[model samples]
Target: MRSIWNGAVSFGLISIPIKLVNATENHSVAFRQIHIEDGSRIRHRKVCEVEDREVTTAEIGRAYEDADGTMIPITDEDLASLPIPTARTIEIVAFVPAYRIDPLQMDAAYYLAANGVPAAKPYTLLREALRRSHKVAVAKFALRGRERLGMLRVVDDVIVMHGLLWPDEIRAPDGVAPEAGVTVRSKELDLADVLMETLGEVDLADLHDDYREAVEELVAAKASGGEAPSAPVADRTGRKVIDLMSALENSVRQARVARGEAGSADVGADADADVKPLRRTAARKRSEAASEPPPSRKKPARKTAAKTTAAGGAAKKTATKTVAKKAASEAKKSAPRRRASA
Candidate 1:
């Protein structure tokens, strides 16, 4: 949560004092080099190629190679004093629609928080203004001794500043003509649109870094002297050669099923219908049995026999109920005329 930089955001005469906090964090597994045989730590050295000796930090200087193969050395102070001005202020030059900028131009993002109560007003104003206009402000500032171009946009009522890649830094795709054209049939386009319709809404929370998780697991296994885990096998069977019209129909059906507009039986009618209910019944029984307390193994046969005998006795009693009721009524009628035999 530490602020990477503290500066003011300037737009015309308004300036908002704010601190920049890094928006992202590295979650990759880190490792150190070690001797495989002895498990000894390995250290790197800074060696000078010409002298054939190790050099200290003080001996190192920045150098640029000239076109004539001459080495031009420069000190840190000289590089700092270069013609490029390192402005501490994020000076917004222009505002443009957010969608107009390509996502690839974004290098890094940071959170901009107002430093004090006096700065909060301008910060809020800029954020609300950006949201209302549906645009982001293109700005420039200096960080880590380099002049950086950035985009300021509102995210969840907070100003999010993103460092942008310079136009020169982004290379155009090579070996291809910019004016290349390809023809698409109407049927193919229609099918493509149907396929796109099957896709659900984008949910950012559903996305996860599977590769990073696998790498971390591998590292942990190796550290415990275990073999590396196997890579996941991909299923490549049942590849289809699509007929445009048929594919479009199938895609529409799938989309309807996904949205619960069509029943399961209506969607996959030809597939084994008996298998689904049977599987569901088996799963339900298994779940019920799993929830119940396990029967005691001790004297299990005796317990079963006792339960059976009790059920038989109850059945016999119900069968003789009419005779027993008639006998009881006769006894009551006779006993009313006699005195108690005290």
Candidate 2:
């Protein structure tokens, strides 16, 4: 990458020579204006409105208009001779905790590198110091003829300079935030927390510009003489916007569903209450079936077939024996007492 600015970082009496390279870039496609009638490129010309004639680049000059509409031309040479201390050096104004700097103030970033081998030591020292202390250096520098406020910090072991918006440049967020006295419910907050929990951790790598991709697709289709893609359907469902509490609750419920949890905000509130009993009854049945002994695992019964047969046989044998003895005695008695005495 080409270095855009050559400057030095100044703090106290020390100056570390550094070269600045733009940290970010745009990947957007550029479109040129064309004539719809002839499909030809459209060209614009510089013209003098007062003279009604064409003007060249060399004839153009920067000018300031007075309150009375008097135009006073300012020469490029006049503006170039002004004293700008920030032009050659980025002067450190203060070293403050990184968190103290608002992200809204950041505008553009640049990668800082030592201009030469000799400047590397001091650059490394400052980078390490910022990394260890977790601090950002508020600095001032001039770029493109404008003096700019900036923050210098270490990003991924490399020192970076970010141009910051001026105090007047940042608008108060009072108009952007919710109106005062518009209270939020604890229930709503709880549901929002649940939604956040369901959302899980953020990974910026997963985020992308779908609009850019769609634009490229549209261009490709048009270039190939194919049918143009249809526009995306706008969501007119004000369900979320109209009811914050309900929306948060639904979001939480949907996230739970995604995570395979039991929840349905759209369903009745008593739905859970009704579901629990069925779950319990099913669980109880399972437990009862588990507790009951298996037929194969049971001990033999007291009235089993073999035991019943043996008992009946024993009773019959005793009865028959008794009857036979009684009959013998009776016959003896009937036959004669004399025979028994003999």
Per-model TM values vs. the true structure: 0.63, 0.70
- 38-139 per-residue lDDT for model 1 (tens digits): 989999999998999999999888788999989998777875577653356888989999887788899899999999899988889998999999999999
Root-mean-square deviation (CA) per prediction: 25.8, 18.7
What's the residue-level lDDT of 164 in candidate 2? 97
Candidate 1, residue 196: the lDDT equals: 70
lDDT of 2 by residue, 160-181 (tens): 9999988889888777887779
Off by over 4 Å in 1: 32-43, 82-85, 174-181, 225-228, 235-342
Give residue 235's lDDT in candidate 2 (0 to 100).
53
| Candidate 2 deviation (Cα RMSD) | 18.7
Clashing pairs in 2: none
Per-residue lDDT, model 1, residue 206, is 88
CA-lDDT, candidates in order = 0.79, 0.80
Q: Using alpha carbons, what is the TM-score of model 2?
A: 0.70
In angstroms, the error of model 1 at 97 is: 2.3
